[model samples]
Target chain A: MAEHTILVVEDDSTVRELLKYRLGKHYEVYTATNGKEALDQIEETIPDLIISDIMMPKMDGFALQSALQADKNTRVIPFIFLTARADEEARQQGERKGVDDYITKPFDMETLLSRVERLLERIDMFQNQLDAEIGRDFSNRLLPDHTPDIDGYELDFHSESRQQGGGDLFDWTETEKGTYFLTIGDVMGKGLRAKFYAFSFLSYVRGTLHTLLEESTSPAALMGELNDMLLNDDVLEDTFATFLLFHWDPHAHTVTYANAGHCRPVLMTPDGATVHEHSDLILGLEEDITFSEVSLDLDPGTALLSYTDGLTEQHTQEGGMLGEDGVRDLAVDAYDDASSIQALLDGVLSQSASDSFEDDLLVVWLKRLAE
Target chain B: MSFDAETASSETVIIHVGEALDFRNADDFKATFQEHVDEGVRQFILNFSDTEVLDSTGLGSIFSLYRAISPDDGKVAFADVSEPVQVVVQLTRTYKVFRQFPSVEAAREAFAE
Candidate 1:
């Protein structure tokens, strides 16, 4: 039925044929005489499950697994090892290598079949839960969480995920000194694997940035320090993000901010829409990259919308993306929509074709409402 | 989302990117370029004639290659950048670091070795 794909890699033709004969009924079966052959077969069809024999002619199952793990594309294919000698040491070696499951030489067909089915179910279930998790993270991280309840200011944020977890992250922290800091970042990547990378990056930011934020309120200076931290860190060596950090000074009615290669924010005033065009390089690029901390004093009846590219990159009915100018205009138009930023976001997002956005739409709207 | 590289010389390489360069293929893009870097190609010229989408992640990948080739005074340039890719380059101001040319032939001429 081609419902699923199963790859069987065994040096012995008899075992390979038996697996193909049985698993072929429920799945599209592919057989390889050895681990090297399995890899060659994998280039054509990526199977949902792989059953590999540890002992092979050219390459062993362990070596094949290490090869698969080396590649980002084939890293997560559910792998099982089959061996004749099922000793404790062998099991430990497989465990250390991240083998999903193992079957001994004298294994039951029903046991192997059930294990295969259950593992596939778990994989699918995890995929489904990822959607729900992203939704929860969107709600949990995006607004009203660490946001300060400052006087004379209205702040709101929201995210519409494409359900792909495109790594749009937002966080805010009010320090012990009452210095309010807000940050919006987008980790550069797409899809599930990137989601994990994004999650780690975001968590590290949430965990580590607060202490760093306490050391300096100058957004640009703090950004340089963050750059150094990222450059020196091992886990985030390959990761990159476009981050905008904002410091809202309620007493001065001003917002001081620094941009690390993020999209320009659209500002709405009585005159017209003004775009913040200045920005430094994105994070994790180079050492000693400096960002400028620019301060803007707010006026009554003013609104500023800072967002990731998702807002502007939405496709229109004409198959064109809404560019920077389009976003500025729409944001200005949305500013007059209603009293609520959520309504404004609803209005802005309604511009997309069929109300379906292709990426994660994230925005942090700051409004100085009219007196 | 995909890349093809042409060898102009042992020191220079021209990279052709198509349609999209976003988070989906940023790592692949970097890895692809790194292979050329390993092969002693220090100069890179990106041909983005067919590029329509260039996101922050894609820029980061380009930056990665830039960081790799920069220590030895290596260079990266853009030729025939599409409008969308132009938007990203302008916004990030990466053009300040990486130079641009009108065409791949021009880039090759600039790096003729």
Candidate 2:
């Protein structure tokens, strides 16, 4: 269980120390000499429960509560009043001010602990609720289509589905050929139906890639055969996907990649940003399609950034394309500073005013082995 | 997107598939199929021997038609499902919704039974 945090706002060091002595065993105690200091304490770290005296110099408890409500950030923190006044009007005012519980001065230690314990329990309940909401949002973020994460790379993913689930998918597997196969694809629709298609498409591609690894070493040939099946025999007409397939040869320190109508990924290295715009035709467009492969020697500290159009399609209030260059700049800055890729994504997403997404965004960051 | 429908019996309808069944053409398929369902025609046989391709949306439309018919103890069959179209059907699981045959005559005969 997490330790409960309590902030006690009182001008008297004696009472503060007393409460700290009394509550220290049950809570992580923070003390403030006045309401101003209490608010400052809260601004830095929101305590699980706040206990404040009604009157203080510079800022008072009522004023602090009002400030908390006015600012969206600290409004939800629970507050309780510890006051000397026993007047009916004062008690009514405390209730109206939304103080969770009130304790009179010279109160019995048992009653005070009971009230504080109840407040902490309520805070714990709310925290669990908040945790559940975060869990739901994270699930929606990482598994929009409910496709299980790639066998070996589950932690390196996040998904956003607009209505049901997005069609973007990624998978990784180490082949018996002493190579690792990484695949990412975006099917051309949304919702459960689109999710089903995305899953079906990935199933076909991943199964075929695994099966073919024993017979072939060329990623381009595998894509060619997969495309042929999709184009010639697949009943899906308008159904198609833009995909990128990669084969990493550990022995040679090289990676071979092929693309089909997907966005050009930015490969960031110490030299600078290299745009890998390999092909134009989408899969399932024709019966006998051939894909070309690009071979590169993996450089240590090299990072490859691949993403769906959803990320690029996000526009500012001014309707500017978040654009390839904008993302490239972020990636370059992050790669140069050796910042985490997730941080780069968070920075870009925070810049947008609205959290609503137009389509699914699938992003992958792969780092080449460092020498 | 163009389709031709023939009423075979009080319980059966035959829809002819032509051109591509894709996002652009799904509306034509939906509009016609909905019209049949609205007309109290439940049983259906879709001739896919000539259809070049059926995308996810098109396959979904086929499933919707089957749902519309199967509830009334009606049936839908596919006639002359070409090899390529059959592959898509198999992948999508839509082929399981109806009895498919090599020729329209077989589909029509199955409907008679």
Worst 10 residues of 2 chain A by lDDT: A146-155
- For residue A148, what is the lDDT in candidate 2? 29
Question: Model 2 over residues A215-236: C-alpha lDDT tens digits?
Answer: 9868789889877766554455
Query: Evaluated against the true chain A, what TM-score does chain A of model 2 have?
Result: 0.56
Where is model 2 more than 4 Å wrong at Cα?
A1-155, A233-237, A336-339, B1-113
Determine the C-alpha RMSD for candidate 1 after optimal superposition of all C-alphas.
Answer: 7.4
Using lDDT as the measure, the top candidate is 1
Candidate 1 local lDDT, A80-102, one digit each (tens): 99999799998899889888998
Model 2: share of true interface contacts reproduced: 0.00
DockQ measured for candidate 1:
0.58
TM-scores, chain A, per candidate? 0.69, 0.56
